[model samples]
Target: MGMGTTTIESAEVKAAVASLREKAPFVYGLTNYVAANLSANVLLALGAGPAIGSAPGWTGAFPAGAGAVWINGAALMSSVTPEALDEAAATAHRAGTPWVLDPVAIGAGAAEYDAILGALLKHKPSIIRGNASEIAALAGGAGGSGVDSTLDSSEVIDIIKGLATRLDAVVAVSGEVDYLCDSAGRATAVRGGDARMPQVTGTGCSLGALSAAFCAVVDPFTAAAAAHAAFAAAGERAGRRASGTGSFAVAFVDELSDL
Candidate 1:
C-alpha cells in the first residue's frame, strides 16, 4: 500500500481515471504561453479545476486549495520568473503536494533554463514527462535543440531509466508509443493515441497537466498511465471523425470531454 511499492495495474489505472471525474482535483499550472489555453481546456474537459499561477500574487502564497501543481518548462517565465519557479517548486515540495514537471524544450537552451530546471529537480516531482530529446538533454545526454527530437523513444530508454532513477520520480517517454518508466526501472507501454494526436499542438502539454490531475489521487505510475489512457483514448476517437489538423484540434477537446 505504500508509495513506490505497489505494482501498476490496469484496474488501478482505470480507477484513477474514474476518481478524477469524481474528485475534480484542482490543478495549478506554471506552463508555456503557447499551450496555456489548451492545457486549461483539456483539464476542464477532464473535470479538473485549472488555474494558471504567476508572480507577486502566487509568490508568497500557493493557491488556496490546489490539489496539484504542474510546472511546464516551456516559454519560461510566461507568468513566473525563474525565482518564482523555484519558490513554487519549494512550496509544493514542502506541502507534499503532487506536481508534474514537463521539461519542455529544456534542450539546447541557455544556461539559465538549465539552472532553473536544476533547481526544481531538488524538489522531487510526482511525474516528469518529456519527449526523448528533452529528457535526454535533461539527463545530460546528447539531444536536439529546442522541441525537436533527434532520438526515438526507444533510443533513449537508457537515458529515461537513468533519469527516473536519479529523480526518484515516474518518467513518461512520449512517442508513437508511450513508456511509463518508474524509479525502479519498471516500464509500461501505453499505446492508444493516433498519429493525428501529434498534429494538434499542446497535446503533450495537456498530457502533463492531466498527469498532475491524476497525481492528486493515485500513485505516480498509475497517475501517468491514467493520463496516457485519457489522452490517447480521446485522440484515437477524435482521429476517427477529424479530417484535418484543425478539425482534430477541436474534436480532440470534445472527445476528451466525452471520454
Candidate 2:
C-alpha cells in the first residue's frame, strides 16, 4: 500500500504501541551481537516477543512464524554466514512478511560484509533505518567511521529519498530529527528525543527492532513513524528522570514498559 501523504500523529503511534500488548507479536532478529540484547529488551518492553537467531537452519522457518523480521548488519559472525542471511531475507520477502533492515556501520566492517549487504539489497525490505553515514553509503555515497555519522541526517535527505525509491522501501534517517520517507513522495519528521540517545550503544538498532515489531501489526510507513514517536516519547520522559546514559537506558526501557 502506498503511504501517499499520510502523516501519523503521536496519539495514533501510542495506540499502535499499546496494540502490541494485545497482538503479542513475535519479532525475529538476525541482528548484530551488540544490538541483539538491547533489541530484545526493547521488544519485551513494548510487549512483543523477540527472538534473536542467526543459526543456519532458521533462515526459512523463523520468519515464517514471526510477525516481523529484522536484519541488522552490525557485527558479522563466522556462524551467521551471508548465504544463510540471504536465504532468510528471501524467505521473508517471498512470504510478504514485513521486515526492517538496519545497516549498521556499513563500511567500517570487514570487506566481505559489504558484499553481503549488497546482496541483501536486492531483496525488498519494508523499511531501512540508519544514520546519515550508513544511509549515504547504502546509496553509493562515501561512508563514515564505525557507527559515528560524518553527515547529519538532515544533510542526506535527497540521498535517502533516492535510495528509498530504488529499493521500494521506507527509509528512516536517525539524528536530531528522524525522517521517514518513501518513493511515493510521502515523508514525515519525528522530533522530541533526548540528546543523550546517541550516548547509548543500541538506541538506533533498538529503534529498527521496534520498527520491525510494529510492522507486524501495521504498514511500513506507520511502523517507522510509530517507532520514532514511541522512542521520542519514552526518551524524553527517561531523560527527565535519569542523570546520564546508564540511568537513562534503564529509565527508557522502564518508560517503554509503562507506555
Candidate 3:
C-alpha cells in the first residue's frame, strides 16, 4: 500500500460505523493463531461480541445469532483439516449468516491455498478480504510473493474485478489503494493509511475481523467502507503517536476503542 497517495471517505465511513452499533451481531472468528485473536479483540473494541469456534465439532454450536463470520486461512492450512473447515463453512451457510474469507498466504503455497480456499468457498462466503497478492492469486492473477501482493493497484484491478464476478462476492483488495468490488462490475477505492502499517503483524487480520463486524449489519459496500475507515483511522492515529511496531499496535487498539 502507498503511504500518502489516497484519501478515505469519512462521511460514508461514519454512517457505516453508526449502523454497526445498532445491529451489534455476534461475530464468529474462525481464524487460527493468537494473531487472529487480535482481530477478535479489534471486533470487541469496536463494539461487537466475538465467538471463536473453528473446530468442526464445536462449529455446530457457533452462535446462531452471529452477525457475521470470519475465516482466516493464516494457520488453518497448518492445523485445521480441510474437511473440518468445509463442515464449519456449511454450518455457517445453513444458518444464513454472511461469512467473510481471508485467503492468507495465497501467493506462496498452491496446495495449501487450494485446499483451504476450496473449503471456504463451500460455505459461499458473502465477503472476501485479503491483501493484493492473496486477492490476485484467488482471482487467478499472477502469483504473488509469499502472502504479500506485489502487483500495483492498476495491474490488479482487472484481476480483482474478474474474480469478484466469478465468486459472486464482494472482494476487498488491501494495499496502497484498497479496492472493493462485486459481480456488478462496480468497484470503489479507499485511500489513506500509514505506510507504517505493514510494519505491524496483525493489522491485516484485524481489518478482516472489522469487515465481518460491518457485514453483520450493513450491505457489502458499507461494510467494506467501514473496515477501510477503521483501518485508516487507526493507521493515522498510530502514525502520529507511536514510535514503532509495538507501540503502533497498542495505539491502533486505542484508536479503535475511541472509534
Identify the candidate with maximal lDDT. Answer: 2
What C-alpha lDDT values do all the predictions have?
Answer: 0.80, 0.84, 0.75
- What order do you get sorting by TM-score, best first? 2, 1, 3
Stretches > 4 Å off in candidate 1: 1-9, 77-79
Count of clashes in candidate 3: 4
- List model 1 lDDT by residue over 20-115, tens digit each: 899998888888788889999999998899988675658436633578888888747465688767777778888888888988877676777876
Q: What is the TM-score of each candidate against the true structure?
A: 0.92, 0.93, 0.90
In candidate 3, the residue pairs with backbone N, CA or C atoms under 3 Å apart (3 or more residues apart, or in different chains) clash, namely 1-175, 1-176, 2-176, 133-149
Candidate 3, residues 1-259, lDDT tens digits: the string is: 2112223446767777777776677888777675666887788778888877666577656735577887777756447666656665677789888878888877576776666675577677878888877777776666677656777765677777777788888888888878887777667777767888877777787788888899888877668768887888778877799888888888888887787
Q: Tally clashing residue pairs in candidate 1.
A: 0
- Residue 180 in candidate 3, Cα distance off native in Å: 0.9
Ordering by lDDT: 2, 1, 3
With candidate 1 superimposed using the best TM-score fit, by how many Å does residue 63's alpha carbon deviate from the native? 5.3
| Model 1's TM-score against the true structure | 0.92
- Residues 185-231 of candidate 2: C-alpha lDDT, one tens digit per residue: 78888877799988988899899999999999988887888888888
